[model samples]
Target: MPDARTTAFDIDLYHIDAAYLAWKSGYNAPSAFELFTRGTPFRGGYMLTAGLEPAAEFIGNFRFTREQLAWLRTIKPYEDEFFEMLGAFRFTGDVYAMAEGEIAFAHQPLLRVEASFVQGMLLEAGLLRALGIGTLIATKSARIRTTVGNCSYADFGFRRAHEPIWATRSAYIGGTDSTSYVEAAHRFNIPSSGTIPHAIVQAYPDELTAFREIARLMPKYMLLLDTYDVDQGIDNAITAAKEEAANGSGHTLMAVRIDSGDLAAWARLVKSRLVTAGMGDVKVLVSGDLDEFKAQDLLATGAPIDGFGVGGNLAVGLGSIESDYIGGVIGAVYKLSWIDLPGDDDDRMKIAGSKSTWPGKKAVYRFGDFDHDLVTLDHELAPDGGRPLLHPWMKEGTLLHSHPSLTEIRERAMSNLAAMPTWLKALAPEQDYDVRFSDELVALRDRIVAEHK
Candidate 1:
């Protein structure tokens, strides 16, 4: 008889530990782990390394509550040893990974964890969940960063994101300079930025009063124009900038944001109005359904828009490039490459069907000139027989890594964007990069197939 209790694992990489607990406790992980386990040697060439921090956090805290264990015991015949194992579930695995902010391509051993088979196995659910979701957002945001060029962008997807932490961290990693989420800013030290919502503009008797109240509170606040009348909103915003300047508050109306209508046209019109009103230096910002293509289209006009407030499409993503949106997708797979049990001469591999994993661990190298378009081998071997992709992010539960400020990450992302190849940078027809495994890995793969047969 089939055990209907078993379900699939449907999470990003970092959420694997949580997925394990959830699966054991009668909640479903994302995809079918049974199927995943069957494919011990995955077919894919590389995986996007992501979500290691969150996955590590989940693994370090993975434990079954006594209540949960007791409930499990009540269900059916249970082994005392198995119950004890559950009680003491801790991931003492060591993970080698690329630094979180580093740019990575499709197929490279992004993360490598070494631990007892069970320990590593149990962490899969949570790890995949965290990594998958984050990478998706980061990849999507990278494209927007490309199209928008030097213009600044902010995260405003707090209300729509699956979790607040996800919203905050995802936006941060996805290349947004600041966020509208106050709690995210407080927790992660990410800067909190916002003008007023359209509701605030509509709440007052007139747009001028609403603008006045906001400008008074934070004199240099970014003003949102287009609650009802967009043209009038610009006029009102100009009036507010003038008043703020005359009051000798030293508060300059920093920027005015246009949310709807033909953004390029409206931005130009608003810029003209501000210049006419002697507030020529005041910046114009734009939002509402912003994506990479739209950002490029608006930028092409050379509008006076200073930056953007990217919400839905950027924070989550537009859609998949080659795979599905949900499920344990990203086609990001972890494969068992070596089996060395003490007495073995060297590492061994197991190959079956389209599943043939390279053995003896791996490293990646960039083979091209980074100065020109920054093209890289998807995963090139370093002559030293070591993997270059996995750099030290953390060591022994200590955050040995020093993450740069959000401003810094934004600047670095911009630099990377400028250097990326035109063909690979577009968010369409997922660019196919090259990754080559060493002869030793190929030999190991061949041996596995022979032994299994």
Candidate 2:
């Protein structure tokens, strides 16, 4: 695990320079930065907020280490005063954010930081990374959850995950029933599940022996098929299951996993064979570079697949070529939105072409089953029947409250997913949910732009 006490050196050198320059030039006004993405990931209608726990931790514990400061002295001819400031620095800011697992739209502020200009600048990279990757994985898992419907889904992507720990947590938040990452499971109290690998079957003289041994050891076990011959593997599994039942050793044959071949066809065949052998209750779980699209296709074929164990597609964010839509990446950017100087408060924005951003501290108000969202200046009154999505997370550098449990976040994700409009849930949604800016927010942006002109 990385240190919970994030050091100032964790940020990019440019951000450090920017902060240094700001401080040197006496530009030490309070500033607000909003973390938002310009568009949804995976061509989806919405994203699930995640990584708030880590982001908050980073902000709460942000400090400069002695070693880091010593190293900084070697790199640049910065003054002793700056080092003194760095050594004494602590984040004394406020953070407002949507709860983890809350559904968010493009341009909505998932997290907003109210701090000094230097503090806000220093937080840009870390906040973006933590929230961006976490949100991407969570959104992908949510799509998979939608595809699988009531069927079981588990994360088998640890080996392929960019960061196994975060991926596992995000996957669970996205509605997976379990994860194969044991460490993550232990840390987060997520249910961990897995069966023998193909290598284990290869280690044995025959499939039946391996199956028998696994059944003897485990109270319940899923046999791995397709290591050699699918038919022989299935036959051996059935034999082992029957023998285990007759032996009265209290072992249960829970399911059989198919990792290769035409998964849908194989699942149907496996289901029929299990039913014929009086083991119909046993599940048929399939895994092989699977994603929501493939899972949906397989289920549509009525493959009798009871569960999915997704690996690479779930762990890694390699976008699909067929869909021509990038996966596994959320382009969340942290931009300065408001600056509070002595007796002067200024709204800020970026107007470089399509990258223009909304000015001022903002609030997102959701209404009517996520049918519409209104973005307005933070101080604006909520539209009637509007539910404010952003809430106070931290005040004066201290967390206002503890985060909800992972299970609670997962439930929230599922509930939000269920509330999504039917058309938005489609694998290729053609319409976007209504997201609009309040007239005041638009007017503020216009005024800022006109002033710049």
Candidate 3:
């Protein structure tokens, strides 16, 4: 699904955890959670990390609407003081995170948050939701890009996107050259691309007339070829192009789009006809149930496809989730890693075995040209020839720096993908690229587990 929550008002739904919110806020015993969140697509060994900027933006502007607060008051176990404090709550925490578009491996903390128990805990749902959907789209887009190479890929998932806002953004970040989501185009400064629907031809006297009118209205147009017979649609497109050329509007059909039939065969036939008619400059665009696998199959036929409009599958992630707006959610968690004890600073972690987590503030460092990563205690310095991946994205409620433009972020994503090892990039991974955990940290975790057991 494309971006779901367009306005801040829609965020009132985060009020879902009112009781826990009230309880954690007042439980004053020096509580803290080292939010070591990680999320990815299914069978994924590596993910192109993203959503940090949006998550930070949500945190920096954290708020409960008046209606949301009023509703929270209706829930049981929430005292007046809780509501009073909730109305004034601000995320005055410190955040360290991998830059959006960095390559992130499994079990590594893509983001870490430090603040009081409540300020941090309250943020978990929103942050994880944003991170999960964005990460999913980015991962999927990269997979398609790996297969598509230099051809242009645009996001046509806007209508089917569970939500439009993040979905479009995710698709773009994931590597779509353009998007059909108009508002997202305006907001992100991305070039808007879309084709006329079948309804346009239906509204007109005939397909040829619709194409001619549309071409007159806009010099460049991708005439939808499947609304009627695919063959006739191409013929109409050529006629419209010729008529427009005679009108001196100087427009030829930008491309001929096929939304149905065998994409590969149709694309080959369409390309062949366009060439026979001396319109070789025109391109063939195809769209119909496209995932990376389908896109791969289409390309495998050696069809002359110049562009694609990917829907449904691109909107859904590798795994499915029980949600109306989205088909999936990444499994991510926030847990207490530290709680101040008088005169004591022992490392702390959950001891659930296999569900256990590392303790203390953590840092992720990359070795070489994104060959691998090491997760170490924050105080430890980067290894020789190693570069720290996490940087101070935010500090004490203020942004540490302006966010990189989406173009820059997309370039970074492409760089990360280009460096990926072939095995991990396989649709079914050959092996996992584990993030090396520090020896001392592992020992401390073992010690904690033994004592708890």
Candidate 4:
């Protein structure tokens, strides 16, 4: 094998140091502190600091192998100078961030990385891409988790998701209690659970045969109905469930999942049939491109659906969020603010319309009473009084503290979700959430925007 020295770092660590070095040089920072300081390059009340741990790992262990460097030589405009620079890149930066699973509103910085412009700038792409996508999914997951109440929601979007890892990470982060993809579950420590697929049901001569075989294999399993005849499918599932229950195999009739037809009516009919047959304990799980609007509407009907299996719409971020919820496509640019060295002030700005960024490090305060958990539109709490939501996650390519485990993050997510008003968690928009900017950040943005004009 080629010597480790000649290789690019591990896949996870591939971009951290290089990204940091690139960022620093790209922005021409005199020192790392200058790139992330108050009145320095990054100007915002605060950054929504995320993906630092992975980014840090990337930087600390970054080394381009002879193989990677050789590939570099294959490209044109490959300056010996740039190649030489790439040879020695390593990331060393400080990052302040919100704890994973913290409730963040639009326009708020979720995580911020502070390092020399060279180091920080280099790390930008991988860091943002890693953190932004996950957080976006996690935020959406929190909302969906909120609406589901006590019912179990599983991730069924793997086959339909944009990618495999998304099926794993995004689905789990979003509030799916389980997944049908075993690999996704194994990779992310998510639970894997499911009922029979239509293909399996299609193979059998009749629905009863399919149900008998399935129940025989996994006695405690949930069974899928709605193949040829919806009513017949339910009757078969009931018969199979009853046989499994009677065997005293400790397998009670778990659930009958419905995937087609009018879900509300079908669910009611199925429940009525099950109840009539003394299968009151059997649940009715609904799936099939369910979104918040559909789920909420179904819930409004007081149907017999014990659980909902939302697929494409929830997993892919469909109509749940309005374009305006993106809120003016607010430019949250990461910019090169001030670079204060001995005799040079490289305090400059990027081009306009590229999303202007504020200068200096910053923070935000959310003011409200604990009662009913109200977050006022413009009223900010005294900075000292309100609990600070953002904190230090990393410094100089080392983690500042143990990032909370995924379970902890999930728990925190649930709490924040519980505090939100039902209307805010509604599938459709009533109003944009109100969040105030600190006077400091507001003033800084104004100054920068005016300068750009």
Cα lDDT for residue 237, candidate 4: 86
Q: lDDT tens digits, residues 265-327, model 4?
A: 999999999889988888899998676556777888988888888666544544434222331
Lowest-sum lDDT 10-residue window in model 1: 32-41
Which segments of candidate 1 are over 4 A away from where they belong?
1-50, 320-329, 341-360, 368-387, 392-419, 429-431, 446-453
Q: Estimate the TM-score for candidate 3.
A: 0.89
Cα error of candidate 4 at position 118, Å: 2.6
Q: What is the per-residue lDDT of model 2 for residues 157-242, given as tens digits with 9 covering 90 to 100?
A: 99999878888898899989998889999999999999779999889898889988988888989899999988888999999989
Model 4 lDDT-worst window of ten? 37-46
**In what order do the candidates fall by TM-score, top score first?**
2, 3, 4, 1
Q: Give Cα-based local distance difference scores for all models.
A: 0.61, 0.88, 0.74, 0.59
Choose 1 or 2, whichever is better by lDDT: 2
TM-score, one value per model = 0.78, 0.97, 0.89, 0.80
Candidate 1 per-residue C-alpha lDDT over 34-61 given as tens digits, one digit per residue, 9 for 90 to 100: 1012110112211222355565566555
User: Any runs in candidate 3 off by more than 4 Å, and if so which?
Assistant: 1-39, 65-70, 318-327, 343-346
RMSD in angstroms, candidate 4? Answer: 6.4
Q: TM-score: which is higher, 3 or 4?
A: 3
CA lDDT, candidate 4, residue 107: 42
Query: Candidate 3, residue 45: CA error in Å?
Result: 2.8
